[model samples]
Target: MTTQHLEHPTHTHTHGPDCGHQAVSHGDHVDYAHDGHLHREHSGHWDECESGAHTTHDGHTHVHGSDCGHEAVRHGDHVDYVHDGHRHAEHDGHYDDH
Candidate 1:
């Protein structure tokens, strides 16, 4: 079995007075086959922020506050694995051996 790995770095920023402003960060990893079709895995963690605060991740920010009250903000990551046989060959037309 062959293994391929990749890493991605991320950053986050938050602002607020009652919740306290701060920054958050996390990392991600992926595994796949040489043919770009196989199993995959990933994991990461985000810094903790307070309620009524605005948090920004990877350029997207969530403001935690009601019309004019305090609110809570939550975020997370996702992972997807796919196994395709002819998906790439059909797209690139590079399948020499049929």
Candidate 2:
């Protein structure tokens, strides 16, 4: 019998205050950004922004004060990633939380 080798799943991520993957960023808002697809729960805005506004993450990652369940889709200036079917939509404003 011949022996075969199996490969392990690789995971390499880079996200932080100064992540280079960021395309458009302002204060705590990001747009047109696309990170690798690794199937993981990303961060998002959970609390109010004092201005009674709810932040959203289009097709990118966003860290929050607490853990948030945000996968992301094509919203606003965010990049489209419907190749595998996640969810997408376009708005007048950005839906990404820096």
TM-score per candidate: 0.18, 0.21
lDDT per residue as tens, model 1, 1-98: 11224332242322233334321221232222212222223345222211122221222122222342322122222111121221011112222110
List residue ranges in candidate 2 displaced over 4 A.
1-9, 23-32, 35-98
TM-score of 2: 0.21
Clashes of each: 0, 2
Looking at model 1, the pairs that clash are: none
Candidate 2 lDDT: 0.31
Residue pairs with clashing backbones, model 2: 28-98, 56-95
Q: Report the C-alpha lDDT of model 2 over 1-98, residue by residue, as the tens digit.
A: 11122222342444354655433332343332433321221243111111123345555443322234434442334433322223322334543222
Best candidate, lDDT? 2
lDDT of every predicted structure (CA atoms)? 0.23, 0.31
lDDT of 1: 0.23
